[model samples]
Target: MTESKDVNAGSTASKERVAQFNQRFDFGSYAETRQFLDELAELSKRDDYYPDVSFGKTYANISIDGEGQAALREMNSTFIADMQALVTKTKN
Candidate 1:
């Protein structure tokens, strides 16, 4: 299995800790929410990055573990931006 990109590959002692970034997205309906999730899954597959996600009928809460190396942080930020863009496209 492929290792998670969010993890620091260096030794444990030298690992850098960062804060988590959380966001909640409200979708129009359950169908829209699922569609967003599907898009997220595709994005994750493409980027090899996946965040913690919780969802209800019309909402999804995303918690990205931003704690890691600098490259990981950048990846997380980009992932968040892409997710936001996906939501915007879904709403339009």
Candidate 2:
């Protein structure tokens, strides 16, 4: 995949045409990042929804597809909020 040189996430092949929400988080260590990813996986399993996830030792990038539907957009928002909570939990 091509790296996004634009901070706004604009790139030649960056799924710009897709209606999706994206976020990236930085963690203190590999263990913390792994825990966050694990929690996200569990949440996805319980909700029966999965988002595109990419991660490294201390960071994670999440992309939730909404497909331009209101219901799906709302769900994505909630999922993001829930994931944020998990981040907080992992921090502590």
- Model 1 weakest lDDT span, ten residues long: 1-10
Please provide, for model 1 over 1-92, each residue's C-alpha lDDT reduced to its tens digit, 9 standing for 90 to 100: 12345444564324425545678999999999999999999988887877788999999998765342255566654766788999999988
lDDT tens digits, residue span 6-72, model 2: 6665543345466567789999999999999999988887766777788999999987654423444
Q: If scored against the real structure, what TM-score would every candidate get?
A: 0.72, 0.69
Deviating ranges (above 4 Å) for candidate 2: 1-19, 68-77
Residue 43 of model 2: what lDDT?
80
Q: For each candidate, what is the lDDT?
A: 0.75, 0.75
Q: After the best TM-score superposition of candidate 1, give how far the Cα of residue 52 lies from its true spot, in angstroms.
A: 0.3
Candidates in order: C-alpha RMSD to true structure: 6.3, 5.7
Q: Which ranges of candidate 1 are over 4 A from the true structure?
A: 1-17, 68-71, 74-77
Instruction: Give Cα distance to truth, residue 82, candidate 1, Å.
Output: 0.9
Q: How many pairs collide in each candidate, listed in order?
A: 0, 0
